[model samples]
Target: MTSRYTLFLCALILAAFNLRPGITSISPVLQGITRDLGMSSTSASLLTSIPLLCIGFCSLFAGRLAHRYQSEKIITLFIGCIGIATFLRFFTNSPWYLLLTSLLIGAGIGIVSPLISGFIKRYFPTSVAPMIGVYSTSMVVGASISIGMTTPLQHWFHDSWKIGLGFWCVLALIAIPLWYTVIRHPYTAKQETVQTQPASLPLQNKQAWLLTSFVGIVILLFYCFTAWLPAIVEEKGYAASYAGMIGTISMIAQLPATLLLPVLLRVIPGRRFWITFFTLSEIAGLAVLCFTDITPIVASVCLGIGGGGLVSLTLLLPIDKTNSAMEASTWSAMTQAIGYMIGAIGPIVIGLLYDYTGSFVPTLYLLIAVGFVVIVLGWKLTQPESSQLEEQTVYQT
Candidate 1:
């Protein structure tokens, strides 16, 4: 690989890293945030859910925006928005204000989510699979680091939860200048512009939607686990800090899976086999989580293995099913938007159930059942099919 290509890949990876840390960083600090703001668990869960809801709804517009303007420019502008949103969190005292900020932050991430896959397709055409693997791995590393550090950072800042939550803005700020350099370089601009309108509306293709739905289901499961697992562990008699650490461990386990899955794709045919295997692995993880009161460490590792693999597989699906990066990006956005909308319900529903029933058992059971549904939907999605007619029929005014 040439030096220029290598640097562009690094920039792409850095961009991926910035995407999720903002969302995941809040989980570990939820207790503090709730306490500081005098909000209920339901409201705190909204803090997490609002971004997810925005990610789902805002993603539909990303393709249009990318078409109207350069993706690099859109990415840089929204990333700056994310930094500004994070910084603004410090001044808000009301739950509604925080929720509004969440909407802004979510929109910023929603816009960038689809563009990353498209960028990979444009710049690293020959290396799509591996580059995506690298991207997913970088995202996992960022999420893990954020989950692991937020608590300590809170302690360091004299137990100021605001400081812990606000520190993640630094990542967004750092990414802006790097994104600027990547977008401004004439050579990089030329390479990206060469394929500006690559086929992104894979939703118009039946096979693409099948693959997309499978990817979406996986995302639904991934969001459920990430958003609620810490709280679930806390229900199992662990401290909030320990539960947060377990969430961190679950995210960290994705490193190996993300790094290895792309290579595995080289040898694996029949995408169904890989999809079914990981979907069942996720079901098993949730099953273990539902039935066992084992040590937090042991349970967390089991859940982590499944959770990490599930997310990695979801990200990998776009690359596997599509022939071009534009398709992958479009599918990524559509799936994430649709799936995250579904997944956003998990934490809120779980919180509501706990509120009414005064127990987490029913919620855990509901999640386990949802895992089974994910497996069924995932299997159907793994098939090479598309929904082109459906999309066109719906889109035609």
Candidate 2:
């Protein structure tokens, strides 16, 4: 398309990239934060869960925010808000203050999540899958870099976790100006309304629910793995830093998988086959992770492949199921809003299991169960065509 359109797409992807790493980065350094703050594992777990909970709840308001204000403006403001929240973490010692910052950061990130899909639908109508793939890939890159660097940055700054954690604020700040430039251009602001056609509700559409459930399960698996894998590896006798590095490596695997998925979608008519393949891959990867005492490097490769593929497929489902960008965004919001609520529970449940059993086996077993559920849903979602029913949900704006 035009240079302007290309630039806008880059801006959107950059924004997407910024969304997750900040949150994920904290997990790697949770030990440091826990030691410094004198917190319990349950409290540490809350730090991860609180953001996810907010993301799920706040996503419901994302569409309304986009409707009331220009989406670009809302994105810019919230990203700036993210920067502020990140900066605040460096100064806080109290868990309450940290929790409040988590809420702010999570809400800011949540507002941007659904809007990015909607923005893509509105701006790059024909290129949704590739663009979203690129977006998802960027997110993985950012998460990898953030997690990979946390320990080194902490060491470099004289073991000051605050400085290590605060470094991500700079990335958030960089996104703001790029977002402003993109949103200011008239071409990016041309508003197009979706033609509303009444039909059956998306929830009533088995295919749509299947797609949503697939995304939920994938996210559930992904978040649980990210939240606990480091500790799991540590339990297996690896260093904390090594465990964190493995998590980073696992996140990096998404880059290739996400980039390839869009191309595959074009060649493959039925999404179910691909979904089934990836879901099984996820199951196999988790099985290896649990059953094998392989080296950290080898196990990480398996985990990364499974985690990356699952996340890429989750983002791809909305675009695959919808005919237009509006439908895609709406479906994305609904699925993510509902699906993520379920996914957010994974880490907390895993944490509770760890506390009760004092072993990672229960958590691993739970993940394996989630993987099978995803396969069941992915099999249904892979159907060659959209359902005959139309979505009946009302757009609140």
Candidate 3:
């Protein structure tokens, strides 16, 4: 790789690192945040769900924003938004302030995530799978570290939850310089001659909606369980620390697969077997956690591997199916916007069910049913080999 590609590659990996740690870090210590902020179960659920809603809403405009302002600057600015908001967590003792800052953080993440996808498509189209693998790997590493370390950090900070949360701002500090370097050189090929700009979103296309739903299902499963998994584990008679580590397992397990999935796809090309197998792993994992108490470790690892693989697949779908970086960005932004909007329901519904029934059993069952839907969708969404098509109908914007 040339120096430019190497620098941009570093920037992409580092930026991926920032997008998730701040979000997943909080889940491990969510109960503490609630208690400290005086949040009821319902309000606490809203705390997690609200950011997802912001991510979804702000993501809808990421493509246009990047087009107007340019991708590199827009990404840097959004990462700036994330950093500032993460730092502000140091001062936020009130639930309202937390919510407000989370809104800003989510907005940054929402915008930056798709742009990162676009960046990869532009700079590394020939090696999309491996680059995306690196991207996904960085995210999971960040996420797993935060979840695993938060409780210890909280203890080290004398049980102050704010410091545990605020410490993640350093992620942004690391990312900003790397990304600044990425856009400083003209990385993306100038596509001025191509008619890539769309008249409107291609929501009317069946494939577009299919891609949207595919990611929607993934995010719904991801955010919902991530938001509440620690608390649920604790309620299941595990200690808080144990629950937190177990939660970390679900995220850490994603790393190997994130690094492996791309290579596997290169060898195997079809997405159905991978998606179906991992989705079943998630089901089995969740079922083990819910129905039997025999091996929580095994269950957590299964869930992690499954959820981690989906992250790779969902991110890949837009790029795989689309023809150009601009098209990939547009489809990715749309997928995130629509999918996250739908996925945001998981936490609220799980919270309401938990509060209403006084058990997480119902919550687990609901997630399992959702997995069945994911299977059906994954079955259809699996790309038929290009060679299999007599004539292709490409999704156009």
Candidate 4:
């Protein structure tokens, strides 16, 4: 625990705090944005999903970029860009400009997310798990704060969602200087490069496809809820602030499950069985949402447990199944890139389905079907990785 590493820890936590609030804070106040911009449900859903696409697309390239440049410098630059993009939201009058800024925000976050994992492993190899827990919890804090505060800010600032949404820029502004000062130091500059081994593009491996799609399905389900849950609750006669409050509760519920799920999977065997149980949790949570109007809080908590657990567990599988650090990194990059792109389809699909049918019933049923697909994929996950094959992605360095 040297002072240098301690500083790395601070910068990382701060950076994690910025990653999601800029992206997620808009969810609670989406109704405001829609009305302010005169947007349809489908277009609004696109706004949310497009950033996810950028995150997925950029994540694949982030690894290649990190190999060519100093990761700390890359991280510092992206963190600053997130502040700029979030601040840009304050002046957005048209939907296209808003989407453009969302793309910028997503790229900054996408690069930071994968690179932070590598950074943690490099600087705190022996303490990776604990540091991950600390930073993951930091993300949860950021998301919940955004969900809880956005509505209040809207009301406080003369009923303007623009100010409320853009308020998250302050977090990025704070994180940028902290990360910059730490990374500019000499200690981080002299680290040896990590030797990498090539693994096939995820498309080449059938099992990898299963893993990618399964995680993507989980992600799809996760975003569908996040993107529209507040609006749905509002349709049910709750205030936007109340919807935000419930969203906050859902986010708070996510932290403990996200922290603990991977630990449970590691200590206990039967990866298939645990995976099935987690997938069932998603189906069950969606069922609750679809069937019950009497208990939104109950449904939100259930959804949180399912979403957090599935995301954490899926992330763990890439590492557990890979043979080496390079293989693990490859699997993770491909899985996130491909799977997230697939997952990004969820929000827009839900929006379009709702717009077409004028009901959410079809959307919920579709999500439940995706959950069953995850169950099937989880069963196949019991099979071992394809290690003997030489197929792999081309690396730049």
lDDT of 2 by residue, 1-397 (tens): 4788777877877797678866888878888888888887767777777787777777777766666667789889898988899888778777888888888888887778877877777776666667777788888888888888878888999998887777888878788988898777746355566444422226676666766677777877888888878888888888987888888877876677777777766566445666667666666667776888777666566667767767776776666566654566566776777777778788888878888899888788778888788877765555345442212211111
TM-score of 2: 0.90
Candidates in order, TM-scores: namely 0.90, 0.90, 0.94, 0.89
Root-mean-square deviation of Cα positions for candidate 3 versus the true structure, in angstroms: 3.3
lDDT of 1 by residue, 220-293 (tens): 66776787788888888888888888999888777777787666666664455665676666666676777776
Q: List runs of model 1 lying over 4 Å from the truth.
A: 186-204, 384-397
For model 4, what is the alpha-carbon lDDT of residue 201? 48
Using lDDT as the yardstick, the better of models 1 and 4 is 4
User: What's the lDDT for residue 233 in model 2?
Assistant: 85
The prediction achieving the highest TM-score against the true structure is: 3
Please give the clash total of every predicted structure, in order.
Answer: 10, 1, 0, 3
- In model 2, which residue pairs have backbone atoms overlapping below 3 Å? 272-382
Native-structure RMSD, model 4: 4.7
How well is each residue in 1-397 modelled by candidate 4, as lDDT tens digits? 3778778888988888988887688887787788878988999887778878887888787666666677788888888888899899888889898989889988887777767766665665555545666667788888889888888898899988888888888987787777777767735443553656334445677777778877788788888888888776776778867877778888888888777753654456456666677677768767877887766788788777777767766655665555543355567777778777988899999889888998877888888898888888777666545422112211111
Model 4, residue 207: displacement in angstroms? 4.0
Minimum summed lDDT over a 10-residue window in model 1 is located at 388-397
